[model samples]
Target: MSLILEEISVKREHSFRSKIDVLPHIEVPWHYHPEYELIFIEKSHGTLVVGDCIDHFNDGDMIFIGPNTPHIMKNDDLFYSKESEERVIAWVVHFKEDSFGKEFFLLPEMKRIKEMLINSFKGIRIDGSTKYKIIQLLQNLHNSDYSQRIIILLQILQLIAQSEDLEYLASDSFVESFKQSSNQKLYKIYEYVSENFQQKIDLDEAAKVANMSKTAFCRFFKSKTQKTFSEFLNEMRINYAQKLLAEGKLTVAQIAYECGFNSPSYFNKQFKANTGKTPLQKKEHSY
Candidate 1:
């Protein structure tokens, strides 16, 4: 059984008109579009998978994804809490390439904007004072007419182009392939691992999630994620451990157990191997 991932479709509606989708949760499968995407996640928390990068995103986080990039926003399970009817509000502005025209960016007047788009391949996170301005712009775009909306998008892009607080999120391995298909098996495998990485996960259990035989699952998982199942699980555990260590409250041994390592000695060895530093060393460096 193959894993099923969400696929996002890119639509080219009009030449100059951009589309803004506001939704609780975009249920699109793992897919990419040709146009550039500016997403403002207002009130949501989840593990964001962008290209080859996976990281957690909290409320008020805004990201600019380049054209043809594969990404998804997986909401936290807490979103199902009944007390919160307020859905995940996100403003996704999708615009075609050269929507502003080819000559528009080439002009000396738009050099900075051009440079910013070039840097967007790594993905950019909006921060600090620029956050509110961009948010307001996105809100306004939702109400504006087509021409005005285009202008607002250009303004937002220009602001991102000029902001210094933006940070890139993905690696160079995030090249576009556009070969995504439904991976129900893979999603099940990832879901299980993500939920159980804090405990010992046997290959038998993981393979069972995909309903595959152990040997076949091993080869298939490695082919999809480019890492062995055990390696991926270890990396996830180490990432969680790193977060705990950064908080500076957990003892090394405590963190080791909390992150699912059977013993501190084994945890220390794995930590050093994965991070090139001991747990204490990581904590000190963080400080």
Candidate 2:
């Protein structure tokens, strides 16, 4: 995957950009853009990394991201398999501070939204009733004329500003210190791990991918992602395993091997450690 500094395309007739993405998988690697973003996932489940916060995202998940915050969503491994029919569907809006005019957001009447936008520098996940409302508004946004879309966009921001269902995804320290210079190397490591996690991974090779010593790479990865390389790898494997278990097309042992675990016993141990449930138990719960 190439290092991406995404450029959001807004048409000359439009002040901001909005669109729906329907794909077999999310292809954007670790990247950032100048525009703030609001994304609502209509269908999907996967690992999402926003700054230093790593978490699982499911259908109906939504988040707002401030300008220049690096983020990525890697669909579960099954989505990448040719035999899997899974799809990812989402609505995304991208706008800049000048979307409404340079000083529009600086006006006294825009204080609440200005504060919310500032807080979004760390990335924000919308939850509860607010999420549903925004999703609906995004739908309306897609069907509206330019004037109406702009109105709906402001309404969406207003709802988010007034609601209590917001959780910041990245940490204060990360937002304070992050710069684009480090992303190319870090994106290499992430892309490498995502592509190779279904087999043995060599620490030396991973370090070389980041152009660093093994010890230094380990520390840098942990500092950026807030998880050890091993932990991140295991989490990726477990995430795929969970998806397979939910599908009920394979035995637990089959899933273990498919997800790169050498022994079912070891897979069971790790599954429970990560999710507090054995593979079989998780399968049962899925049904």
Candidate 3:
């Protein structure tokens, strides 16, 4: 899949866009835009790929992404199954840096917010009491009057600026490469992996996606993602396995093969290596 440049337009009556999205499932592809985004998932289970970092996300997860950062949140396999029904409910706000006037963030009182925004180039995952407070504000944001909504937005930023429970999700090297390079080729490589991670993927085949030889492609992928191709592939498989375990619809052995692991024992080892827990343990805890 090529990187899609999403176009977001603020309504003429508003300075930024803020709303709640309720859908059968999230249909957005891997994409980027010029606006910074704050999103809180009220109800969902998925794998979030931000830049080169891959991780599982659950209900109540919140993240802030800076302008033009590439990201996508792909729901669990069950969400897409024809026999199952699940809904995605989320709060999303998109605003440009100058939404409050270009000079607003440069003011003396805005120092911390300015730094936080800069750090968001790598993407930030909100946690602890900060996430709890933001969830409340996000709920209020969707129904409040225009003037009150703007004030609440600033308050949310102020809270994030003062909190210590934020985690940056991407590496500096990945962010630098992403900004400097044309990402269409990178997106092609990602699309190939996302579509075929459930089967045996050949290095030569992946290299062909980028139009490079195997050796050259290996080096290029590692430089951009900070992980070897095999490591990346394992992480992707393990991520899918996590969702399946959570659903508890299949045996661990079934999940192993479904996630492309030829041996259930090997799947157990890698599952623990990536998640710090075995498949059975994760399945037991999910309930």
Per-residue lDDT tens digits of candidate 3, residues 38-149?
9999999887878756667889899999998888889998899877789999999999999989898999999999999988988999999999999888879888877998
Residue pairs in candidate 2 whose N, alpha carbon or C atoms collide under 3 angstroms = none
TM-score of 3: 0.77
Q: 1-287 in candidate 2: lDDT tens per residue?
A: 65578977888989999999999998997888989999999999998877656667899899999997778899999999999999999999999999889999999999999999988988999999999988889889999986998899999999999999998876665565454246677767766765676688888999999999999999888887677888777876886788789879899999899888889999999999999999988999999
- Across 110-222, the per-residue lDDT of candidate 1 in tens digits comes to 89988988767667778987888998887788777757866888789889988887877655422321234336575566556655666888999888888899999999877
Task: Return the candidate ranking by TM-score, descending.
Answer: 3, 2, 1
> Which of the predicted structures, 2 or 3, would earn the higher lDDT when compared with the native?
3
Residue 176 of model 1, lDDT score: 27
Predictions in order: lDDT: 0.72, 0.85, 0.86
Output the better candidate (1/2) by lDDT.
Answer: 2
**Regions of model 1 farther than 4 Å from truth:** 1-26, 81-86, 102-104, 176-267, 284-287
Candidate 3's clash total is 0
State how far residue 11 of model 3 sits from its true place (Å).
1.1
Regarding TM-score, does 1 or 3 come out ahead?
Answer: 3
RMSD of every candidate to native, in Å, equals 5.1, 5.3, 4.1
Q: Candidate 3's C-alpha lDDT?
A: 0.86
